[model samples]
Target: MPSTSQIRNDRTAVAAWTLSVSHPLMTLLVALWLLLFANLPFWRTVWQGVEGWDNGNPLFLLSLPLFALCWLYLLLSLLAWGRLTKPVLGAVLLVSAAASYFMHSYGIVIDYSMLTNVLQTDSGEAMELFSGRLVGWLLAVGVLPVLLLSRLQAPRRRWSRELRVKLVSMLLALACLVGIAMSQYQSYASLLRNHREVRLLLTPSNLLAAVHGYVRRELRAPQALQVIGGDAHRIAHVGAAIKPRLTILLVGETARAANFSLNGYARQTNPQLAKAGVISFSHVSSCGTATAVSVPCMFLEVGHDHYDESMARNREGLLDVLQRAGVKVLWRDNNSGCKGACDRVPSEDVSHLNVAALCGDGECHDEVLLSGLQDYLDRLTDDAVVVLHMKGSHGPAYFKRYPAAFARFAPVCRSSELDQCSTEAIVNAYDNSLVYTDHVLAQTVELLKRNGQRFDTAMLYVSDHGESLGEGGIYLHGLPYAMAPEEQTHIPMLLWLSPGMERHANLQAHCLEGLEDRALSHDNLFHSVLGLMAVQTAVYQPERDLFRQCLAPRQAFEGRAGASGAIN
Candidate 1:
């Protein structure tokens, strides 16, 4: 026998609970929690700011509420799409969770370049990234919330009314956010400037921005290819007899100059290259800090500032120009594809070759790039160029890059989980890969010298980009260029020229060696190649060419040229 007042109160309480359970506000709260929890790495970093308060200033506290409101704006705005909210938010959570796991585990950041690298990754690289850790994180943080959200029922409301409510709520949230930011502009600016990596690692936001940029740049139809150097042709000195020329452009992957002995590293990482008498350029930098950017940009006439992937993709590259000039060009790849740099030239993938000595289950040793290469070389005619794109020192499984015999450095990091290994172990593994690279380069030079009798030969080895080995708690490469550390940009470059090739270009070996310490970058690659092969084009800028100073004075030829037969 309950009293009337108590009975009425109980009914009211039940109605309130029912309203909350079925309301859009309740859904927004759930979405906010899902976003924050899914991005654990971001929250962890934010927690650091909490612990690092400046004398317990209350203004610093505003960041928390502002951040929550900002997320509310994002979530509610997304949810206003009616039934699509569940699917869209669920997908965002899953992707953000996966990105968080990798960023936390591998010390990587989510950026446009990283997104491009992810989308462009081959099945082999993708397979290597599969792990139980990823599965566990996805299930715990990504899938469970998605299932819950999918099961939850939406509030019954007219579409117009719902849209109006969503718009008002978003406006209120944004107003609060802007007010807070404006009030603490100095603090915010200082914090962001000092910790730039924070923006790149901020999950959900970083992921969204990266996805948007990728879609805008890569998914859309590209512009038509712009032909460059269409009037390219080679000219010969009258008295200097034409000799068959072979230049090997050895593109190394992830080799930093700081780790090479020839560049004054305390370790003897270049024992073999040192013995072979190759001149190592001590101050060379790459155009970009990632393979997807550097490989193609290195072969383009564009500099770092003006380098655009869209433009690079649409324009003919150095290889195309050389091929148009009637030079025989071949590209041999042991890593990933050439990223369209070799599309207009003859190219081969040696990673799939059947040489048991040089290949494993899915990938081949760099040595495989040399197998049957001499046959290809023998078949080429005069003024030839070959590019050997080696899979050198690509991480975090650096131990797999070299054979056991080349594992001179002991107690190396054997696991792909680099964080679990000690720093010494990681360096040992990375240095061992370099030692093997030294061996490979030495072997390449030996092979070139051996072919000197048939044709004047030269070899130029330059890494696409450098690697970061646990510097500033960063492992691997691909930080934004402005924020990139020296390790990611400063690369190793080595050159070897036979006496005959040197004389043909009117360059002395000692004179070229004297310029080893001069500052150079991937910007020099295009013009240098043209200079080496004697390809004269309207686009050839002598100021940009590394070998231009070494060449004898030229009386510019004014006529179309004919290809001389193979020099004998």
Candidate 2:
């Protein structure tokens, strides 16, 4: 053992050897380190995206890193103060490491929507995202840099001198950035324009921008709730003689259309739904690539093309409109809580229910949405709309979505760390979840059929968004809408109408079957529901309603009771 005096001397030497630098110098070095190591995803994407790179100008390739370094250095200079230097850079490094891992491991980009999804993710879902590989990645890239940063010290200088140095450094970085841009303006412009998502791959910059955007949006002044469809009133087609209509809007999660056998998948993913007399719309697309955006957008009359998140949050949606029209509206969710779409309506999140068979590991399967559903339906005596939001195929733990009995697909991926599993195993796990969803849908139809004597019932199932099961190396969802693949946008949709609903709405099953190939999307959801429920409002565009053309002329129902002013 060394003596106390010797130990003190050794500590003093170690302290003296600690790297010390000016704030500007520290920022520059950190920026360079980040550009090289923290942006592998960015570099990889750029390398692959560059058209004809083998024959392309070498100068263009050189300019890419030069521009990135200058950009990062200039941005780093904003917070490169004496005390804030290490802490800020350390935080950036840690965040960049996490962002880098996700971007590289799963081909996702950090965007406003993705950031929103992350912020809104529940503890159970967040837990599923945690993996050993992620911890290792963070240790290697995030924790190590932060640890190194702790040893380094930025020696304080005169305030005026420090400011001057930082300003000069920023100017130099800006100049280099400008010079690089000028040298390859066309190439840079083409690259950005063609692959707009590339910008969202930049490590710390992407994370910072996304967080900034989210904060700005969230901190903005609250808007007054805009109540729409004030003139809404449900028209009775059969007077008091016929049973009331009960429309169950079954919203599915992460169910891609490509995997749905009803949409022509080779695997029988939707076996139960296939035999349940449902009309599966093969060409249905989703409003957005994630539940946070898609759920609210689908409820808005404006549709995805014109969707404004702020506007949607402050406005009355389809459910509110239905309620205003005297249709009892209730939203029961097994997934995330309706993404605020059901805020104004009667909503229940049954995900945390402690039912023995359906609930375990802090989550209930999609079947839990059906629990106590019959009792609720039995109590309903009026025209009503019930939204059953199923946790259908929500991943990366696809196996957990279904019970073991539903795990008919052999050799399924049992772990949430999806990348560790073979693609075949992942698909098997996902398909099994869909198989469970199928059973749930079939059970819903059976329940509707059982209640047909008292109510004319229908079930319309549409997924909020689709999932990406390792397609193009992209796993999970929430790539920006423009860059999302068919697996992330194309969703499975189907309709099951009871015999009474078929006659009451004057909808022929064969007509709907023929219209299966008709291109539809979440845009049609708002108006189509209005048309089906016989709710008349200015927002109910007959042109957009899928059922409008399929319905017989008003003249056909003219002889019926309460038929006047009913068919809008």
Candidate 3:
């Protein structure tokens, strides 16, 4: 029995609560909030990408926020159902917060390739990316919004009303989007066409689109493996008695050409390699800026331009072709797995060895790759190809890549938080890692020399991709190939052929040296390795072979030959 005024006050409070928590109203509010706060990175990119901002076009500028708002509202509406709105939107905000931190700080865009890199990254590499700043960003933009969202309670509505409201809201948002686009059709069309990457900079939309693409390509029903190089067979030298061949393909990670002294860098980063007389190719590019893409793409016969991750995953690549040709192939990894390149071949991973000197905390120095390697070579009784994937020059923990004894460059950045260190310190740590890689390569050469008496030996070293050390505000690699800085795409490649291998292949050291300035890329690797192994195959493209032009003549290797026997 309250008075009339008191009853009126209570009813007013209930009405206000219902209005605030109405599902459609809350969805619009959250969408607007995200448009203002969660999409700073997207707004920044748009502002910078537009030419002549001082005299900005009124319609174009008006369209920017209007389009973003309508787009976000429409996307959010799809998830604004009962009991699903808060949880799903909260997850998006958290993910968008993390994506924004990376996009703003590192100048990286969200795309399928970058998403593949993230999904393939091992625990060790992922841990290196963690920092205090990342946590702070999550707390501010991610956790706070999620907390605010958790407090909201959607007002329950009948099915008929809910459906009607959703339909009306979506139609209005769609109409607004259409209006904005039509108002500035020319400006909007030009901006989008000129800067396709801008679409990849939008916050949760880019992330969601990438996730959808990855799931469609990777998580779909498995396709049957496409077999290539079925007619592959090794051919022996005609005249001279052929000895067993041992070719080591050393794949380095994150090693750039600009830092290697052999490639004209001022520092003596390649002192050991230079003294070993390795032929360092000065001009070579990688297929991709990340290990996930580059490793698999380099192994494909299709090369980079025609490469497709799903197709590559379900196809026979270089190792499979080599194995089919009766050549014993093995892949030993110290970084991550071979990204499915070694799936069909025998492989080993030494990244978890517990050696006292070379390994600690579940990680090992690249030198651990040499352990038992010499023994394996000594036991070889047939032609074999071994790929040694080294953990070379990978950052932001570059200081940890080398042992203290090899830390020749003083004042190294010892922390994984790269932003905390000076550029000079970071370079010092990275250069020191290269020095250690040089040492490991030289030692590998010595091991091959020891086995030269029994087998013809050779080594080919090429990096999967390069790294970015605070170049143009880009700290790490994985930028899309078209927009990637030269520091991330230009990689180091070199060759070391034992005198016995030189004679067997009829390749002159002088001729190989003369071709150092020739432009090359990961595209040449497949055909070049086939040519180097003397494997005759229908898939082999002679024009793409690096050693094809250097070989003396076809007659030199056309002596009495037989089909190479498979080693079981």
Candidate 4:
């Protein structure tokens, strides 16, 4: 019935439709490859333990899905311009590699040396990055199917039997993707998989459909910032009653509670603190496992499960409450990176300032920050609160950071290459860092004594989280709470009330008589600061305030076994 030219065009149209449908399937498969590599918290470290790739650049939590979408977009955009070919493949890989390399070098840099070490061919860094067993597995598992699919599908194919089979196959592949996404514990509480990520994967028209849902929700939802509970703004500051001129709170980074000599660790890494009469709270626990989650949560009135809820009630934070009540709060950090906790607080990341002569250029010692505090205290009012975020044990290169003075015992490993070093060397290098951390605490106490003439002072110490020193071959922190050992979450804490500050604030009596002995947490730090200043917010509970009162002496370390991995 139709002319010859018309029949020829109709077949072309069907083929285009089949190819268009199959591109999404291709993108989904690649997305699965990237996601599997990154879901583990200690990705490169985990691979290294298996004698796998020495380097693995993790995709940001939202970046892997973006990567997949970009690949699909390239195919569609180029296909729109014309057909696919070898040059197009080359261009796509070039663009993707450029983007990935940039992110690898600068994305939050939990271990900057890990990247440098693995990428250096002379350093075997390149070998580690490329030859990791996981990467090999990915190539074997993912590349073969992809090569076959590319061979079978033509850009201008029709809806033939083979194409229908491909369509069904694509859906099956996507289902597997969904299953993998569902398998991760981080995804258990989230189903949307991030809206931006989903939109990125869809076609432009489909993306608009996805956005409409977002817009509808935005229109219907109430303001998230509105107060749902206690009025942090109206709360009263307890006042300048505590006697000591100032209080220093040292929040240590990654010093595990179990490893401290004060905790009965046979390692004797805590010699300086033991001599200085430091009473380490052997059983202190961290509220969360990661810095981004832990630091903000520690400063809020909300519990971990509802940290976002607290963000609404008060964006003001602990410093705000302290300032309103008239205690000057100053934060100086030489430690692991700061999360948003420092957003509204007066703070410094002195990690780059090599103040401790213990290590060379660019290596910051936590004690160096401690040495500088007396000058900072002198400038502040007598009734002040100073918080030092200490870089106690941020690791991988643990052996190189501390000075030989603190290297108490060792035929220690001298490099970050934990797998190549003996277990004792790994343990020695790590324990020496702990020894130095204790010294830093003692120096802080002596600084308070030197400034004792102006006002009474006290010092309280807490660690953000603990570290994993080669336990199960995972050599650092940030594992999912479910898989983390007690060493990685159990942390040390202490409180030494200066004679004057305690007597002046009437907290001296409170410190000596009001509180009972019991295990405490960084969760208590938020309310305790309020109680110390005497903030009159409804959220202030004595039972929850470590400074005001304690329940009983700390008992055995507690651990929760379920997926939440909450420590009791």
Candidate 5:
């Protein structure tokens, strides 16, 4: 026979346990835990996510960790203060909601709309932001607890056994969570192997680079833009252009050409591009898995082989060569910076995922770039080179970025939540995004065609890197270099040049000639761009150049170079 107080305490514990279990709190907490934990390995990802990471965003870092503990504090309050009054809890909920809304809606560069923009899948930034698809969780974890505690009429309930059981369950859950986390940590290297793009956004090394770049703020052009080694203006003298101001290089973000319909992914993802008569390269490969490396590597003098070795020392590159050769260079980017490629030239970050573009709506669309593109074209100088970096296919929250209009395809062939949705649903969602990318390319080409009278126009489109949507259990890019897949390394490359434009540059002959659709890698970009622009720079690497008749044999099976571009 237990004493009266002990019996009361046991009953009390049981009652408390029931409240926790029955309420949506436990489940909501679990969801949040999984969401956060799945991403915990990359601290900055979730860190940069919550709006407080940036100095501009002005969210107190301490406040976030403190706010995270609020639920526990609230539970304690319930235990001590008994049931909170309806009006009081309601006000508290309202205030919290308002604050959350304000924080989420304002001053943040990312949101859920990009995820919804699946129809326009080429918008990679949307995909990255969309990876946060913890929907319904907001209501359950956020509003329900407050509502229930305040609304329930009873002041007391016996919860002894229930409490003990609940505590044990939570502990087990935490243990399982720990086990899972540990497994992820153990598999971290392997996981990164498949998701090679992780180096781009998450690695400490990358963070160090970003921090250093920020400290240096080296968008400062290290060299002056002057005509280099030639008549600079005449394309024919250098040997490619019949007229100046005709070439366009649209660098896509996070687009894996393999995923594009152009590469035979079984989805009509590239329908619009196909309809627009765009020439899709079947076996084009990106040199590096990350924009940080790939973008610069493609534009650098030393290719990926010596990029890391000599990037810091060697200052001159394609843009420098082009600028010195007198072609105008303007970068219209939606991703981060031009990663130092535009150091000497001009650049604009046109990310629609920015706070100003998506105020309160929480639905930043990738098409926003398209809206402002006309103005960009109009601003182009006669002999100008423009680079449009679209946010293509970046993601984890694959479903929320696209609007209802772009959702033409169905069954979502695959889902972002991996196991929750069918593989088809996930693929469908991803393909839908690819579809949007096709549209973007089409629109871009049309603009060039429409502006043919103003200048001879050509568009070169290539993705920064590829993506992994539930392939090998990964739903995003950022795979480690050592274990990146053919799917991840292989990407779509397209050249949409007007017949006149191609002929002017004398590249029309090779337009469809040698692009036999085999393996051509980003290593070829350095020289090809020079050939396209006819920029007469000594720094151009002719051996790796795509224009080389021998290399263009179309029988190239694989990129001879490895991740760092060694023979390995």
Candidate 6:
């Protein structure tokens, strides 16, 4: 009943609606906005770098449009493939929002190492990173854009036509980007050269680069285990009784040297350790800034500069060398697994130990590592080395690490949401865990002293990495090693040697005390352990050994020993 003109207009309106539903342009715009909003920190930093620009210059004005076009070209090229557009946008929105919040909040950058650290982290440690701010940003910046993207639809076309369109569009974008770069060659070069980290700070690009690197490393066929320390044997001390030697290597977790009283901390976090005659080594640096890297590296002969995590995983470490040289090696872990360090060694995970007094909800206190200690010791037929991997000061749940009795620091941060708590409360909670570590280490020393009559005994405690207690707006660890703050790398190393063990090796504690303030690191751990247990090996470098000053090397060379051999 309508006029022809009105009917034609109605059809036109319907066609536009169909185009809106089927076309990807709307989704592309939403994606572009989401990317910019989510990565505001990156833009803010870039602006700060260029804030003192020549505002009146025509070139500067031109740069703005060029910069905008650069991002547009990138986004169009990324989203050109039709079916992946919405899902890819959703993923980008979520990941970029999360990365932006953490990168801005903690002043961090994403690279392969940081990505690996995230992938290797335990659930408990990861939980500490969650907060209300994270949830708010995710919902506001991530979810909203994702919802909008989902509601929109892509236009259906022939497969060949779609592929051709995608190829042409991407090639056009590439050409435009190249033209812009050529026009502003000097400016682009200067910006990138001066601010190399800017590349790592890009939102979804950084994430993609990191993921690609991780996947490449993971997908590579694992290399064969390169054998080292082939000429390893235990050297017999002249005219000494054939008593068993027992050394406890206590691998502490996340306890920084800055909090230890013996290391000159204002608080007496190491009250028990101060009285236990343990040599607290200050100025000790870690091999890496996280457990996944530090734990295995500490057990290898490799130094921090030459350390490769994949190599460490494939090869045998100091424990294997000790076990090869007639020493009984046992690893008791209270934290996560030994991270492949004890894969071939006899290892026991004590997380499930049901001592309610020291454990709750499947998490056991460090002292639980001491449970059934004597019984485990009795099973060893020869000189032994046992590693006690402690769950010390691991954060967000610092209060959960220790029992109530050791909660000496008052008004602790009880909640896992650390950013919501006061700095004092967080420190108090973290310090309480340190006090508890001191107790556990002291108890370990006592256990060794009790067994001193049966076997010459000693103990060495070294943390895998340090923790950051709201310092520089950083909480928890695992910033890249090069950019890591001192709090994450400066760890505490303590040594307690019984008189019998001291006499057995002719080593002096005073000599070790003198080296306390000397700069040392996880590199010292491997060779030092080899020296401590008298495990003679070709891999042993006396120059790298911390105890080299205390004991003389073997007077004569000896043949190599296998896993089943014993020194007489």
**Which candidate has the highest lDDT of all?**
2
The TM-scores, one per candidate, come to: 0.89, 0.96, 0.93, 0.62, 0.56, 0.88
lDDT, each prediction: 0.80, 0.87, 0.86, 0.55, 0.55, 0.80
Best by TM-score: 2
The C-alpha local distance difference test score for the whole of candidate 4 amounts to 0.55
Q: What's the residue-level lDDT of 17 in candidate 6?
A: 51
Clashes of each: 0, 0, 2, 31, 67, 1
Tens digit per residue, CA lDDT, model 3, 77-143: 8866766877888888888888888887666889988998888889998888898888998999889
Q: For residues 508-539, what per-residue lDDT tens digits would candidate 4 score against the true structure?
A: 44444323236667778887776554444556
Residue 475, model 2, lDDT: 96
User: What stretches of model 6 exceed 4 Å from their correct place?
Assistant: 1-27, 47-76, 130-133, 158-165, 168-172, 179-195, 552-568
* Candidate 3 displacement at residue 231 in angstroms: 1.6
Ten-residue stretch with the least lDDT total in model 4:
554-563
Between candidates 2 and 5, the one scoring higher on TM-score is: 2
Candidate 5 per-residue lDDT over residues 460-531, each given as its tens digit: 888878876556555455444545666667778887778666544445445454574857777777777776
Off by over 4 Å in 1: 1-23, 40-51, 219-221, 237-241, 552-568
Q: Report the C-alpha lDDT of model 2 over 1-568, residue by residue, as the tens digit.
A: 9999999999999888688878788888788878888888788878877854683688998788889998998888886566788888888888888888888877889988899999989998999889889999899988987887787876768889888888998999999989889988998998898878888998778887898999999999999999889888766565446778999999999999998898889998888887888999999999999999999899989988899889657988999999988899999988878876899989998999989999998999888888999999989988899999998999998999999999988899888777788999999999999999999999899989989899999999999999999978899999888888998999989999988888878876787889899999999999999888888787887788888778866513542344345432
TM-score of 1: 0.89
The clash tally of candidate 5 reads 67
Residue 301 in model 4: shift from native, Å? 1.8
Residues 326-355, model 6: lDDT tens digits: 788999988878877888788998977899
Off by over 4 Å in 2: 1-14, 51-53, 554-568
> How close to the true structure is residue 31 of candidate 3, measured as C-alpha lDDT?
80
